[model samples]
Target: MKQTLVIGASLNPSRYSNLAIHRLVQNNIEVKAIGLREGVVTDITIVTDKINFKDIHTITLYLNAKRQVDYYDYIISLQPKRVIFNPGTENPELYKILDENKIHYEQACTLVLLGTNQY
Candidate 1:
């Protein structure tokens, strides 16, 4: 399993980001998270700021296009194998940026991918 980073993570259990975190852990994948507020989920701590995560194979986004604007450079800096634009987080601008940098990405649902054994 790829080591993943869940961006725009939420502390609320009902949110998909939260569920993804739990699912990723259940599947025995290394997972890190970044959210507005600091918190914990299934032994994973959600940080409030970027920390230059290393060897991140996948970055699954939970934020909308607008919120993602600020993360463009930060995401590229991490140099993940690919970025997953989950549902509403899809952004054409970011896609272009990633493409220019030679980073792979896909607009898909993280939960669905996980459920279907595709993640």
Candidate 2:
């Protein structure tokens, strides 16, 4: 299982980000949830500090494209092999940057991919 980092994770069960975290765990994928707020998801701590991230294979975003500018550098620094845009997160500028850095990415829903066994 690839270690996935869920950016913009939330504790609120109503949120899609939280549902994605649950789905990620259900699929047996190792996950590290990161968000500005602090809370737990799937019995795992939602990390806030960027310094704690390592060995990340994928980064599935839950944040909107407009809120992503500040994270461009931090995300690139993590150097994940791929980053999934996850529905409303699609950003052309970020995609361009990811391409330039040779990082693979896709604009799709993580839950759908997992459910369809295409993740």
Candidate 3:
């Protein structure tokens, strides 16, 4: 199974990123999370720093396109198998970069993918 990184994670229970983290854990998936604020979601701590995560299979983005700009190079450095552009986080600029690097991406909802067993 691929380890998932939840970017733009939130402590708010209502947030989809938070929900996705819970669901991912519920499905026994290893998950790491990072966000602007420090918080905990289940057993995982949402770190404020952009730690260089290893063996990251998937990166589920929750940040908006503008916010994503700053992390473009950082994310690419992690070399994830695919980047999931969850809803409002899609960016064509990043998509082009991913393409140039031969990285795969999907413009889809993480919650839906997990629920449908397609994650």
Model 2 TM-score relative to the real fold: 0.95
* Error at 36, model 1, angstroms: 0.1
Give me the displacement of residue 72 in model 1, in angstroms: 0.5
Model 2 clash pairs are: none
Alpha-carbon lDDT, every model: 0.95, 0.90, 0.94
> Tens digit of lDDT per residue, candidate 2, span 1-119?
68999999998999988998899899899989888888888796897877558899999999999988888998999999999998889899999999999999998999898989988
Model 1 is weakest, by summed lDDT over 10 consecutive residues, at 85-94
- Indicate the worst ten consecutive residues by lDDT in candidate 2: 44-53
Q: What is the TM-score of each predicted model, taking all chains together? A: 0.98, 0.95, 0.98
TM-score of 1: 0.98
lDDT of 2 at 107: 86
Instruction: Give the per-residue lDDT digits (tens) of candidate 3, residues 2-114.
Output: 89999999999999999999999999999999988998899999999999999999999999999998899988999999999998887999999999988999999999999
Please give the RMSD to the true structure for each candidate, in Å. 0.6, 1.0, 0.6
The full ranking of all candidates by lDDT, starting with the best, is 1, 3, 2
